[model samples]
Target: MASEKTDKSRLRRDLLRTRAALPEGDVPVNGHALARHALQLPELTGAHTVAAYVSVGREPSTREVLEGLRERGVRVLLPVLLPDDDLDWAAYEGRDHLVPAGRGLLEPDGPRLGPEAVLAADAVLLPGLAVDRRGLRLGRGGGSYDRVLERLTRAGSRAALVVLLYDGEVLAQVPAEPHDRAVHAVVTPSGTTRFPAL
Candidate 1:
């Protein structure tokens, strides 16, 4: 398992590096296109309440997408990462409500909800370094998302788990561990692709 994890980590890093080398305008454009496609998905379109992450560093920014959702009357929940790597939830009012969170990430300024609130979300938009056809995801190694996803699954929500990525970042396979949280779909600039069951 350790070896597998190491391999996955290396693969994820390589993909991230490649993506980073791409032009900045291209990255955001691709991300926006992907977000547009993802919004068309039934699970996403039908969702009244959605949970999304604030983009930081090289992660694709969801500011425009979130704003569009807000215009459509969708309730957005943004993740607040705690010191212990646990996630708290806060309602997204708009760009004005965002404040700098840990690790240079932006989060909503408001009361936070516990794990149960996350479970009630109609869909979740996740960030990742890379994802495979089997739905296994390679995150930033913090394990924060993995922990939260485990709690959501255990709660029987089965919320649509979608990871946003550049087209080249989606891989045919990725190393996986038993504890890794598998996503249900991947959204790229090209389109939204559903992954096979893990």
Candidate 2:
């Protein structure tokens, strides 16, 4: 456990440095490509409900993707962070419904649909620093998505877990912990990579 933590900490620091060093103009272009790639995923297109987040900072922006999904008549659910860092879901009604929240993140301002709302989603978009060959994801270590994934598992939800990443963030390997869950796929700017089910 101690070694895994140490490895993740180092990997997080290194990935953040690389993301921070990216040219400012690259964010929007990559965001656009991310949206395009996400739409190309058959799971997303067939999904009636998609649980996603409002990408902040250098994280590949989901602003375009969120709006795009809504335009396609998909029921888009955005996360509302609880004070304890657990996530609740809310319906997305375009960018107007989003309000600034903690951690400089934007969340839906509608009624909270409870954390378990994600169980009904056909797809779930996760935020992460990097994902490895085996589909292990390295999040920011906040333990937020861990709880979300755990909730989905406990309820036996079949949501297609997905993550958005820059092309380079897809590393060859990353430290995996026992409690960690593997995502089904990741949509990078270049294209989408699917991990075979374990």
Candidate 3:
């Protein structure tokens, strides 16, 4: 058990470091590609609502995806960090509606819609450090999305779980805990990979 935790920690550190070292000029290019590939996901194309997050730091950008979904008439929900590290959601009004928030995050300035709002989404776009070949996602260890996934499970949500990443973030294996949930697919800058078992 302890070894798995250590392995996750080590992998998180390494992956984050690699992401931090990405060339500044390449970030937007990757973001554009990521958005293009992600928008093509059948789940998002047919979704009436999608629960997603705004990317920060060196993480793969989600700006274009959010905008594209909105342009497609899909309602977009962006996460608002609560004091307890659980996420509260708000409608994504537009790029101008994002307000600077704590942890250097950008959150929607719209009215709070409670955490349960994600239940209405047809799909959910998760932010993760990496995902293994079998679909186990390695989150940032904050446990916020864990709570979201738990809520989804308790409610028997059929919302498709998806992750956005750079081309190399997919791996053969990543340490996982029993509580970890597997994502259905991952959309990278290069293309999308679907896990059939999930």
Residue 94, model 2: lDDT of: 86
Expressed as tens digits, the lDDT of each residue in 81-131 for candidate 1 is 888898889999999999997679899998888756788788999898888
- Superposed model 1: Cα runs more than 4 Å off: none
Ranking by TM-score: 3, 2, 1
- List the lowest-lDDT window of 10 residues for candidate 2: 189-198
Instruction: Put down candidate 2 lDDT per residue, 1-198, tens digits, no spaces.
Output: 999999999999999999899888899999999999999899999999999999887889898999888999999999999999999999999888889998899999899999989899999999999999989899999999999999999998889999999999999999989998899999999999999745
TM-score of 1: 0.94
lDDT of all predictions: 0.82, 0.92, 0.95
Runs of candidate 2 exceeding 4 Å displacement: none
**Model 3: per-residue lDDT, tens digit, 116-183?**
99999999999999999999999999999999999999999999999999989999999988899899
Off by over 4 Å in 3: none
- The lDDT, on a scale of 0 to 1, for candidate 1 is 0.82
